[model samples]
Structures are given as structure tokens and as C-alpha cells.
Target: MTLLRDLPLSALRALAAAARTGGLTRAAEELGVTPGAVGHQLRQLEDRLGVKLVRREGNGIVLTRIAEAALPDIDRGFDALASGLRRLRFERRADTFTIAADPSFSSLWLAPRLGNVRAALGKLDVRIVVSIALDSMLEEGIDLAISYRYSSARDLASADLFTERVIPACAPTLIRNRSDRDGVEMLDRLPLLHIDQTMGDDVYPTWANWFTAAGRKRKNIDHGPRFPLTVLAAQAAVSGMGALLASELVLRQHLDSGQLVEIARDVPALTIKRRLVWPVDGPKARRASAVAMALAAVARAEADGLRSAVS
Candidate 1:
């Protein structure tokens, strides 16, 4: 007999809501229960499972590492359950497909290039959930997702979206003498753009990493004004504020439009992976197949263009 089968789902729901909202009060508000009631259910879940899923940090509750590992699965399960409820409640169209992606990725990359897919699939209702939270899509029944995670749960299917080749890029006007001197040599003269945070995480690439990759290791590698998102950093680079070391895949459209120019095309740097993932079959699985095809088509175009730009 499975031990998980004996677990009360209401307690699980309370725990998932708390994990999602990051607080008991908000989780109670969301679940239509009192804060104390939510806390009670959470304690019940912990006791039943014999694990401390959360710990108090000041007035707010924070997930333990074990909870962090389990929350994604719980979120995904609740998302599918909600989708099933929605399907039962209302009539839906066969052509509609919902996709979830980070706000920065949606704004910088997909928003500009999605027209191609829309034009190709004129019969589909494409819904985009611009969220930094990876679980938002899963919880809301999105058909597909683009995430920067290196890997995911074993049950879902995923494919590589594009090559994440990190290179230095800036506006055309910023590099007047880039041809006169080596691009790597111009690094000390031009400002560097730093991205201190990306999406939900505070960790991202920096000017120091790029310089060390190029064998420079300058002492003053941390010399640029920091931005919160890669999109903002890329835009600052395009505005001539500084050169940004970002993924060539994300910067391909800007590079193609001549809004941004690669400063260190010959330098090889770190690779950041992004993936497109979907379930094998669900309520919206058929439409998801089409959306996946559309995404794969776009991915090919992007990869090909980046190759041409680099070579």
C-alpha cells in the first residue's frame, strides 16, 4: 500500500498554497480560510509526513530545502487539478494553447518574434503568461513553458530551446574603432553592463566572469552600473551605456536589427541552458503539440540566424 494515498489532500493544498504565497496569511486568504486554520493544516501535513517542510524566519515562514525540492511537483499537480476543474466548468476551444515564460524573456525575445508563429498558426488561440515564477504556468494550466532550468522532473518531456552562447554586445555607435583594434582590447575603455539579478534568482553572469574567460582577470572587473534583468542590461548596452555579456540566443533579434553589435564574437564563454517542456497528454495536450511545433520552428530560425551572425 502507498503511504501517500493516506495523506489528506486539503492539508497538501494548504501547504502548497503557503509555499506559493510565501506566507500563512496570504495562503489563508487564497484558500478562503483563517491564518490559524492554514497553520493548523500545515502542521498536520508536517506531522503526517514526518518532515519539517517549513521553518519560521522572523514573522514569515520559509520553505526548508526539502520543501523547495517538493514544491514544484506539488504546484504542477495542483495546476493540473485546477485545469481539470476549469475544463468541467466551462466550454473551451480546441485551438487555444497557453504558454508560460519569464517576463524578461517574453518582452525581449518572444514578444518580438512570436508574430512568425502566430502568422503560421492562424487558427490557434495563443495565451502567454508572463511570469517569473516557474510554477505559475503549471498551476494555471499553461500548455508549454520556456525555463532556464538545467533539468526538470522525470515525468515531463523537454527539449533544448537554443544555444546559450555568452558574448559581449553593444550598439553599433559604441564601437567606432572596434575594427581598428581587437574587440577584447576595447573592454577597458568602454563601460561594462552587470546583471545582478535575473527573473526570480539573484545569480547571473557578470563582467568579471567574461574577463576571466578571456584570460584578462582585471582587478576592476566589477566596474559597471548593475541592472536587475537581462533585458534591461541589453537595452542599456543598446543605448550605449555599456557592453553587456549576454546569451547570443536572447540577443539575436537585436543583433539582426542592428540595434546591438557583438563586441567579442571570437571569445568563447559560459553556456546557459534553456528548455521547452510540456506534458505528454492532458486536456490541452493536442494544442500543446502544435505550440511545441511552432516553438521548435522558431528555435531553428533563431539558432540558424545566430550561427550566421557569428560566422
Candidate 2:
């Protein structure tokens, strides 16, 4: 009628140590405790079990007959516990993957397609770190990074994810009555939302840059509410605040959902290369390569879909 929950784990450990080491002093040394403490734990265990578990035999101690009979199973149980702990740690490391990306890409692109990534990765748990700096990859233990900047370092492998494309877009309500004007004129009329120019790799185009690409001149190009992240600017555009020079790749959900509509189809889209990078020498390199392939495939498929839709 003794319940396993009522048994003290310390006492069980002391018993195992004593049985394995053959003496209380040696057991105490193995357990990193005093011999007196080990003896006390054994006494507690014996009292709880209503049995004489150990006996003094000259200068050393010996397990009693009943204790000796139980020692093998006890040793097996301890071994199983240690083995289980090791397996748990190993499985945790095996199943978890860490990736780094910029906040805008992480929020607008990668965050939405994670389910696809998960399916591609099987049971691995993907951890996304919001960062664009490749320098911190080793220090932060990042398994892979999706970044706009590519590195030619000998120790790293890089694969192109996709070229980020940006187009001018805004809520339908913002352009509801402006049907008479062309895309460029409509963009000229609407307030221009801006993502902070200094934030990313200067790849994100500004309203001025978009106008130049369109061969038009507009004043006060920087005269809109500025956001530090592209995702934030996309949200502002969705709220009918202003026309956003939005990343077509990153903010596709908003455009697909009709939360935002492209105002300038004739204007040339701006583009920046985004790539996947990972250490070639690490234990996770193979897994990272597999994940990189999956991510690139997903991006390519989506990009193809977008192109098809646009055409």
C-alpha cells in the first residue's frame, strides 16, 4: 500500500549511491554530501520501508539481504533516469531550430508562412529571432539568418531567398473617388507614408525614389508619418492613412486581402535581394540547409503566384 509519491527522492538516491559505492563515506563523496547526511537518508528510507536496508560490517557497510535483493533493480532505475534525462536534452536540441530575420520580414513575411515551414521541417520547433545583423549570428547561436545583406565569408553558405519588390499601395477608401487621375497623379494626391530611411539596408525605396522611377516629380515626399518598420507602415496604409511604398513580397497578405490596393501599376517596382545564410561547419548546417531550401521554395512559389496574379 506504499505509494511511490510518498517516497523521498533524496533517500532513494542515497540508497542507490551507497549500494553502488559499497560504503557510506564513498557514497557521500559520490553524492557530494557528508557521510552523516547519507547515513541519515538511508535511515529515513529504512524507517519508511519498515526494513533494515544497511548494516555495519567491520570498517564498511553492507546492504541487508532484502536491500541486496533490491539493489539491481534500484541501479537499473537510476540508470533509466539518467538515460531519460540525456535523451530529453538531446531530443530538445534536435527538435528546436533558431533563425534570424529583420523585424519587418519576420512580422510581415516569415511569421505568416511559419506553418508551411513547420510542415516542411517536420516536428522541429522553429525559433525566429528579429535581427538583420549577420555579425551576431555566431554570438547569438542563430542556426540560420534571412537577411537583405549577403556575406561571402568562407565559413558561411548563402542562398538567395527572393528579391523583395515594393509597390505603392493604400486602402481602397483612400482612392475611392480618384478614378479620373492616373496612378502617378493619384499617388501625388494621396499622403505618402514613409518607413524610416536609415533603418534597413537603404534597399527599401522612399516615396521620392518611387516618383523618380515613375518619371514624376512630387514635393514634400517626406511629409508623411514615418514608421521604423515596414510592417507598421503597411498597417498604417491599411487604415487609410496614406499610400505606402509597400513591399509586395512582405505585405502580400494585405494586398491579397484587399486591405490595401496598388495605386501605381505602371510605375516600376523597386527591388532588393534577400538571402538565407548559415554556418557551413556547425552541427545544424544540414538541417539549416534543408530549412533554407524549404523557405526558398515557399517564397518562390508565392512570388510566382503573385506574378501570375499581377500578369
Candidate 3:
């Protein structure tokens, strides 16, 4: 049997219209076509279906038995299609906002604070599109994007959301005695969980970079189980699999809950700036600006709290 999608939609519409209006002339008037076009469409429909759908009865037309049986379902399908299109139009209105972010940022940071965003926005519908690819922001309908790179797109407005410090952290049990050895020496001896550096930029820090930043150099910095995402490396650190060079912002909850502890405090930390980007002008620009302000406020408060805890 042929799929519904394989059937010609125009022919189906012609059949439905001809049956509804009870004549080729009236169907053509409804469809804005000549009566000859309507008749041709009906013939095409019949040929495709391999069945007679209508018959000439004097000056008017009569639906065949099969056509009468199928007309009601076809009419209902068209009604449903119209309703779906209406819903899409309603959702595309300015009241709804879309934010795109990488998976690590979305899950570890932004997802937790979405409630505060909702409370600030009141009735607006907020949508999140999780992705590492910032290029999607250029597509229509995406109102905002949170990413590590500062986009140079002329049509976009961008600002720093926060600069997160990367510190060495591990499960509390991983370090038995802190005072016996040098901090850099101790960290060098521990298994270090590595995040796959797929960003193809120096923005993402590695164990080798961390060691260098700490005023020391170590060999075999690449040894360890590798994870594609920061959150997974963090979990590995929590499980005492190894020490993780983690973003202080993403690891805030884990540190607070005692799942992980900051190590090598005397060493320099790596900083990565997270940016918020949105269209400079659009139907949703005003609302996107409102959301950007709200997000920055929440991020600042959280950063302050993190600093206080560390202090």
C-alpha cells in the first residue's frame, strides 16, 4: 500500500473540495482555479488511486462509494494540519525565547538556575537548545546563546557572562596528608583525569598547561582515562579516579557538598571566560536583553558566593 505521504496533497485537496462543494465549478471557486483545472486534478487523483472517485451526474458530480467513505477523514486531516500550523505561528511570537548552550554549561550551570530566570521573566516561555556549536545562533528564532567563544558576528551583541577559574580538585579521600609533600609534587604523582581537548584552541586547559602554570613541568601529562565532557571528568574526580582540572563555577555544587576539594591553592589558576550572545535587533531582542540582564545578575551572585566559600 502507498504511504499517505506518497499521495499527492494537491490531488487530495481537490478531491476533498470537489466532494464538499458538490461540483467542479464550486470547487474551482473555492480553490481559486478554473473548473477545467479542478476536473483535471480529480482525474489525476483517480488515476493515482486506481479507483473512480467521482462520476458525472447531469451538470453536477456524485462521489463514488469509496470517495464518500474517505472524504470525512481527509477533511479531518486538513483541519488537524491547519491547527498545527496555527500552533507553530503562536510559538514563534516574541513572548517565547530560545537559549543555546553547550551540554556541559547547560547541565552543570544554567539548568540549575532556570527557575530563577523563570521567576524573573514571569509568563514568558523559555526554551533551551543544548549544543557546543555556536554557529546555530546565526539561524533564525534562536534568541540567545551562552558559549566560550566571543562571536564577531555584526548582527549579534555579546558580553562576558563570567570568567571561571580552573583549579585542581579531587575527592577528599584522595589526599591523606597535605603537609608531607610539595603541592605540585603531590599533584604530579596522582592520576589526573583528562578532558578531551576537541575545541582545537588553547582556551581549554590541559594537565600539561596546569603543571606549567604551577611553575613546574611534568612528563606523561596525558596519562589517564579521558572524558569528552567536563561534568564526566568531575564525576571521575568525585569517585577518586583522579584529580581533575575543573572550572570552579561548574564544580561549585560538588565542592559545597564535600564531594570534591580544591587542591594546589598556591598555584596559579586557569581562567576561561563564558560569553552571552544574542541578536542585536529583532522582535525578541527586548526580551532577550531582559533575560541577559537577569542571567548576569544570577551568575554574579553565584560567583560571589563561590568566592566567599573559598575565602
Candidate whose TM-score is highest: 3
- Candidate 2 on 1-311: residue-level lDDT in tens? 35577758799899888877889999999999999999999998888889999998888888898998988887788799888987786666666788888787787678888877775566678888666567667656678988777687888889999877778888888775555123577877888888875322566567787888888998887798998778888899899898888678757889889898877776667887888998887778888888898899998898799789999
* Alpha-carbon RMSD to native, per candidate: 11.2, 12.8, 12.2
Model 2 gets an lDDT of 0.80
- As for candidate 2, its clashing pairs are none
- The global Cα lDDT (0 to 1) of model 1 is 0.74
| Candidate 2, residue 99: lDDT | 84
Candidate 1 lDDT over residue span 13-66, tens digit each: 888888878899999999999999999988988887899998988888999999
Which segments of model 1 are wrong by more than 4 Å?
A: 1-96, 107-109, 112-124, 131-137, 172-183, 200-204, 253-259, 301-311
Candidate 3 lDDT over 1-311, as tens digits, reads 45676767888888988888889999999999999999998898888779999999998898999999998889999999988987786567557677887667888778888887776566777778764455556553678888777777788887879988988888988877775122666786888898875442236777888888777877788888998878888888999998899788778889999999888877778988888888888777767777888899998998799789999
Sorted by TM-score (best first), the order is 3, 2, 1
- Candidate 1, residue 258: how far the Cα is off, in Å: 4.8
Clashing pairs in 1: none
In order of listing, the candidates' clash counts read 0, 0, 0
Model 2 ranges off by over 4 Å: 1-95, 115-124, 176-181, 197-201, 303-311
Clashing pairs in 3: none
